[model samples]
Target: MTRHTVNASILLTDRPLLERPAAARAAGFDAVEFWWPWPQTATPSADQVDAFVAAIEDAGVQLTGLNFFAGDMPAGERGIVNNPARQDEFRANVDLVVEIGERLGCKHFNALYGLHADGIDEEAEAEAARANLSYAAKAVDAIGGTVLLEPVSGAEAYPLKKAADALAVIDSVGAGNIRLLADFYHLAVNGDDVAAVIAEHAQDFGHIQIADAPGRGAPGTGDLPLDTWIKAAQDGGYDGPIGLEYIAGEGDPFAWVQA
Candidate 1:
């Protein structure tokens, strides 16, 4: 009875970005989520955004979550909205991200707190992140949407490596719409107590995403108790769709969902 959402950015890697919506539908997913589709932090043109939106609509799938501009994801760029120098890029993309959400009825927006640039100390970058995140919260709130903060694992430079870390930032943002994104894969990869965190913070969780630990592969492919923790979240009151954000390693991504 659990509902699942596929992350098009991670699933269907063989297809073009926009085309992944149909691929998700073919895989039996009715809702999908994605990171920023642009390869760089630069703002994508309106035409490109439109095409992406149209692709989702034509595929008849719902967009459940989206990330603000994260630079070069494959090359290890996290998110740039926290960088003072990159504020313009983040601000520009906010409108675009929100606009697409408006069209698709998507309410979740993720803000990646990018690592610091050379000579930019941690304290300074954290300040910039706080300011930019507040700005983003207000912008998304205008359209009746919620802003999500996630903790990414294996990327030491990214800073938000634990649920507590992300929750701290959410507190600083101080907006009613701001909430934590509890991504189980990242939490386990970083060695956090997954069930304990979910049990404690389920109500504050605006979104949930999962993949197995140690390999970032499918559920049965790793050692984590994906089901136990998922049930824990639901029992604790997290009714949001759990996104299947994992690497497809030679198997159908929907197999776990079907089971």
Candidate 2:
């Protein structure tokens, strides 16, 4: 069976933010991931960062993947790495994110390139994104970390609508530690051949996150050919933990199958 890292941001919504790590451990997850836990601010207070790290440590589950602060998540902010106006905010959060990584022993970082509001020059934003990604790469290199690029589906007209699209951005940055984050749910939603994608780029991926399509629900509750894709990923040389970034609804989400 393939072991999975639970995405605490989505799976443990029932509990308070600080308690979700323990909740995930109780749910039988030995590893977990998270979006930027702070939604309101790109740069959180030192106390906030320390408490978050403490919670994860207390829970005893390894943090496998974490997102860099983009903007207000619930309010539809995807990422600000490409936004020139928010470049300072992104910069301020970069080292803080790396600091947290040092504390957690986690080396996988997800960087979302949110859509800059309309009328902005696409070229400028893309350039800003390239520069920012490179900047992040330099900081994380201290810890031998990899920065991730994820393409969300129909998310606010975001430019990275596909895995290949994100790969292009990663390449443009020319950072050795940058890699693609193959999210099955987003790929499936956008009509990408999930298996073929895995077959072709599995080796280039630093992380894999999944959920069922149609509703972003737990696996087996939707029509995604998860087994085939997982097998393809394995056959294609991806030996990393696939993260479960789905909604559990009202039951034990980890009950999908034993890892």
Candidate 3:
């Protein structure tokens, strides 16, 4: 049988990170992922990190992945993968996240490419992303964890809109510890064929997340052919958890899946 996990960011909507594990368990999620859990304004403090770890143990919910720092959250930066000025900070953040993952018994973390800079040479940007990813991959390997590089749609930090592009970056990094994170919503928005891409990137994909495209809501709430996509992933030999990373609509987000 296929297994699934919920992104705590979706279920715990307004709750603090420390409280999300229990909430996820109450909501019947066996495993959980989160956006980021660093020293940002939105994250819990050091003490809260300890408490969060305890909560996960008590709730018996596995911490599947934690997004690396989203880069100065108060300023609305998404991440640090492509930032030249913050390369060191980005590396440090990855180290910290790996530590957190180790402490929490998680093995995966997200590496979101930050916003693209206008007028920057495309080749230069790719090189920068590759270098940073290499560093992150080494760190992940050192800590016995894996990192997934997720591509965003709107801005072009790393234009990995297509599976080929994502795979190419992974190849450039040349590290087994770094892989692609296939998000159906982003793939659809970027006009990539989700199922075909999943099949093509089978060996290179580290994790999967899903949401309805138009509204970014629960799987069945929008036009995404989730069942077909899920089947394709299964056929592709993907046995990892498919994270429900979407927003809630009117009622219980899991209602449709439950039925």
Candidate 4:
């Protein structure tokens, strides 16, 4: 009896942003998650925020997770955490994301570690990331929320490419509220043993997102043993909703998981 959440940003792209929540609900999902809805603007207008909130509420879906304003995701920028020039923007986004999460009762926020900035040294970038992550962790602590650090693939510039990579950052930050977002598809693409990761680090997971390797498609569309991996995660104590953060094939995306 595991629950599932839709990554509306990727799953329901055929519809308008505000409409995706209802579309997901219509598709039989009770919960949804998103990369920041406004990609270009870190802090959007109040009206924009209200509208986003209303969409989820009107659709009667719980917002299970959200990513803190990662810069221009479509343009190859992973995040701004490691950028000194954009620190203010990242901090602004943190407050806004937390506010939205509090209104919707969402508890998980993914903070994508940005690509290395040209002028900054590796140690400098790492220090900046630690500071920003600590700030995000503290902001969410008041709401009993968790900050997530995920390992991503497909973007070579994105430094974190394995479970251990993200976990190391979590350890350095030393924040109890910060944890790992073990995205199985990304891990598999990066060549990590998904089964071993599940068995070894499920307890450190704050949330889990999934897609299939070779192609970020629906579970059955590729070769990853998602079902087996998920069961191992469950056995190791990860009881949160499984995030279907995949690209749909020709037909319904949820068809593979439907009862």
Which segments of candidate 2 are over 4 A away from where they belong?
none
All candidates: CA RMSD (Å)? 1.2, 1.2, 2.4, 0.9
Q: Which predicted model would earn the best lDDT?
A: 4
lDDT of each model, Cα atoms only? 0.86, 0.89, 0.77, 0.92
- Scanning candidate 1 in windows of ten residues, the lowest lDDT window is 250-259
Model 4 quality (TM-score): 0.98
Query: What order do candidates take by TM-score, descending?
Result: 4, 2, 1, 3
lDDT at residue 193 of model 4 (Cα atoms):
87
lDDT of predicted model 1: 0.86
What candidate 4 gets wrong by more than 4 Å, as runs, is: none
Give me the overall lDDT of model 2: 0.89
Candidate 4 per-residue lDDT over residues 62-150, each given as its tens digit: 99999999999898899989887788899999999999999999999999999977667988889899999999999999899999999
Model 2 residue 67 CA deviation (Å) reads 0.3
> For model 2, how does the per-residue alpha-carbon lDDT over 1-259 read when each residue is reduced to its tens digit?
7888988888888889899999888877888899999999988888999999999999999999899997998988899999988888898899898999999999999999988679989999998999999999998989989999998986857889888899999989999999999999998998887777887898998898889978999888899998888888888888889998988877667777764
Question: How are the candidates ranked when ordered by lDDT, highest leading?
Answer: 4, 2, 1, 3
- The count of residue-pair clashes in candidate 1 stands at 0
Candidate 4 whole-model C-alpha lDDT, 0 to 1: 0.92
Clashing pairs in 1: none
Q: Give the Cα error of residue 71 in candidate 1, in Å.
A: 1.5
Q: What's the TM-score of each model vs. the native?
A: 0.96, 0.97, 0.90, 0.98
